[model samples]
Target: MRRPLARSWTNWLLALGLSLSGHAFAAHAYAQFGDIRYPASFTHFSYANPAAPKGGEIVLVPPTRQSNFDKYNPFTLKGSAPPSMLGMMFDTLLVGNMDESTTAYGLLASDVSVAKDRMSVTFQIHPQARFQNGDPVLASDVRHSFERLTSKQAAPQYRTYFGEVKGATVLAERSIRFDFVRPNSELPLIVGSLPVFSAKWGLQGEGPKATHKPLDQMVVDIPIASGPYRLGPVQFGKDVTYVRDPQYWAKDLNVRKGQFNFDRITYKIYKDSTAQLEAFKAGEFDYMQSFIAREWARAFTGRAFERGELIKAELPHGNAGDFQGFLFNTRRDKFQDVRVRQAIALAMDFEWLNRQLFYNAYSRVRGYFVASDFEAKGRPGPDELALLLPLRAKLPAAVFEQDVPQPPQTALDPTSGHTLRDHLRQARDLLKDAGWTYRDGALRNAKGQSLSIEFLDSSGSMGRVVTPFAKNLEKLGIQVQYKVIDFALLQKRMDVFDFDIISNRTVGSEAPGTELLERYGSRSADVEGSGNVIGLKDPAVDALLDKVVSATSRPELVTSLRALDRVLRHGHYVVPHWYGAVHRVSWRAKAFARPADLPRFYQPEKLVTTVWWSPHASAAPAAQITQPAPKAP
Candidate 1:
């Protein structure tokens, strides 16, 4: 049976330490500690304590998507795409919460302080923090890192994140100060998450080459980081290894005081999830994060669960936001009508799909925006509104109002099957109101144009999830053409905004920051390689995003976020899909000891690839396993 949720603060704290301890022991021989200062005894199962012995290699087999480590150059990388690579090669000023949020704590930097006006922030770098080559990390390096990232030669994604920094100056040998043109409360969090690179090493290439490069041509051989691990050996298109840094600085800082227990980590690449899962079952890989629930339920039968060989836990994912959804491209005239969007949402039978396809292991989301507990829960209190009402007095009234009402609980029930029919009727009525008519069993507009929509979906499970929705639209006298494409082509089309409707997956961060601006802001619509694949361009969203980025207090930030969420919900830009409960990962019980504080959401900071280990694994003899076929529906 699973452990019960902690009922008290003490219990929660104890549980957190215990969980972290479990992970440290299973992965590496490490020591455990109750406090930060005192040294603790090392044990074979002591993986939670930072003082633990750090030697042993762990092999990780991710469900899908291989490591893009070859493209780890500081100036050229985009998105969080380089974190896994950088996590091994370099360290950032601050790191993400294990749960994967924008709220960063100090890593290379010991602490950060923001001015009351939020225009200026100061970072106190750890004196011992040094690059892999033993050069001390200085304020100059921080300034150089920011300057290169913001320069015109950098990728657009990297430039947008640091464009808010008005100036960066070295205040002291171990300190850097950043002044923002406008008050930006989220600046520290954003900068902290960005890996700091060696100024001397990064400035050598083309003096800063900009434009995009093919994934294959990007460089990954030499990496410079101040973190606990440095890049070991990486074979392109095969595997990347991370070896522990004996002279790592900030290994004893409060934030990183109890982490990075594994001595070495190896990430093996597999093109498909089925192949990856089969490799896990045959013990070629030590762990597999399960995404297909039906397969998991069947595999963890009598012996698997009874023997404690297979572990399943419901991780409270604070950063796991709204269900993955289908986004409509408003740029297309066919999807311009709200009725068409509603009709498409209504005709789909989520009840049948969830029960049959997902084994009822997911939750349906009705809102465009989702919030974690760390995020704004609902309407802000009076104090919060006071701070926000001044900056956003002229904002849309919809921002303050909960415009999109969630479907009734009964309507959300997949077993009832009546909600879809009811919504379908409403869709039909709305279409008629929008001057669309059903004639000869087909929907037509006033211009005598047949109502047809083309949806782009990636091949495999993603395509399967979208197929039912396409059929549902057909039943409503609407034509939906499904175009299945490979992941590469799908990514390219999304980057260029070339699709009508696209089904994609997005994982939200715990601390909702400006990264979201790229997804919904007007300015981001035209930014090349941005995540705003749907091309959303609303002045209201822009204003809300600005408020979210600049709010000084937690209350003010929450209020601003809720207001922004209300607007996005009313707009109905995307039809929400499903959310998994926990990260279902299957691993060899005999291999590595699990951490006490296993992450709820896997991000660059909390990846098992950086921390897990296998005491029995060795380089002398390679184990081989055959790939398995895709799981049957």
Candidate 2:
């Protein structure tokens, strides 16, 4: 018999111990030590280095085009990309990590409990939690928010998530209860991560009707939130400002007691990243979130670094999820063969991309689900396996062993051409098995149809990465073509499932939830507005995902998740890409303070609204730590 991956009982015991002990080191159980740094004055708040800075109009540059906050309601927007940063600004309930860990720590609620049957969940509302307008947060508001979010008139995305909530009823002034048709252990985690809008504000109109106005008009003109910052002026093509909420709730919560220090958080919009970098160098912006590895590698050599205008801070890889390498348009007849998919995965030279483009700044991932605990290795020891077996029974064995490439003993250096050649040979073999034979100088099927693939890339950086894949495919007698389209057009094509293969990045969550359903469930495959863009559907995979959402204990959840991950990998649904294991962030050193315990990934939604304080401003003293009075019953 195979060794168990992890024992459910032992895993639970360990998790319980870690949660109760308040051990800082235990929080990083799965993380490996590299170049992660923590400032001496940093506290484990939502923001990093609370004492670093306090006042400045720090400008943040978003990775995409100017956000369409005015036209889109986050709850309704459905696409491959994560929710807009603006949507995150409007609400806060839960936060996610890159590795798929979703945490429920926020202003309104501290802890959430789901009963054994998963029928009902009780949220312990924070006593001090109040809306931006200084109105006490009531259970009625929570209920109202849910009701509106789930209503058909609201955005469809919000409605889909709340579909599981059979009914939401207010239990008391401070407690709201959710009744579900089936057991779902992930209920609390999911609901808590949803940003809660004031029912009064969101529902304002005749008889709960939703007015789909632009976000700037709804949020900025009349700002209302319980989060760290309130909406400010919207300067089209220039900057959007977020003013600190003076009467913000959670000001005294243990997790966020000393964060959100910036008086004004500004997002300076740029048409392209190169221009953004130029502005960062010119001190036009206070910080730059680096997506272009080549640009980041050359920053130090630029004029910006010589004058001490920029500081490169390496952040611990918080659990923002993976950037997936997808086998797009699975519905296309050309990609029906799994062998073909595997061949495509092998042909791409991620090693070269990492070295030449990324300057050896990233770590290649071989699996769909990245394991957090680096020490656990394969299956947990026998003792741990015993506890995991029951959960494993509900899932496929493939979860533990399928399609996982052997972990590299030495980090791959993309600069080495020898490694690239070996990878190429492996790819060719996989393709040959899939019925593509080299005839004359071109690869073709027995019927003489030439092997061809079109790579749809939306961004310049992704286009550059796909260019080399074309060469590798050509070597194997396969014709490959790449084209870059506008972001909007790409989105439209994705909606209709109209492409052969596309290269794009998806933000991973720290905790896996409905996203799994959206990506792999049969029900989601052709759902008109859902995110199962690749149209994957398998009963075994569905069963594993169901078990994951229903699992009550950590061990049970991990086992089910591991199984689901394995099946996806073995199926070659996605060709894995790279993660730096750290955030490549450059911020104005003197503009804002850093917090001690920073999230693995610094998402704009999570960081922009919280813990970003300006150094020159007079907000609150960093040491004024005090617990709020117990919430009233």
Best lDDT among the predictions, by candidate number: 1
Shift of residue 314 alpha carbon in model 2, Å? 2.2
Clashes of each: 18, 45
Candidate 1, which segments miss by more than 4 Å at Cα?
A: 1-47, 63-70, 74-83, 99-104, 202-221, 252-254, 299-323, 369-403, 407-417, 438-442, 447-449, 597-607, 610-633
Q: How well is each residue in 229-308 modelled by candidate 2, as lDDT tens digits?
A: 65555553245566665556665454455556666666776656566677777788777667667877775356556676
Model 2 has an lDDT value of 0.59
- Residue 336 accuracy (lDDT) in model 1: 72
Best of the candidates, TM-score: 1
Worst 10 residues of 2 by lDDT: 27-36
Per-residue lDDT tens digits of candidate 1, residues 228-339? 7765555644565666666667666655555676666667776565666666665676666656667677754555557777555445543556446788887788777665
Error of 1 at 570 (Å): 0.5
TM-score of 1: 0.78
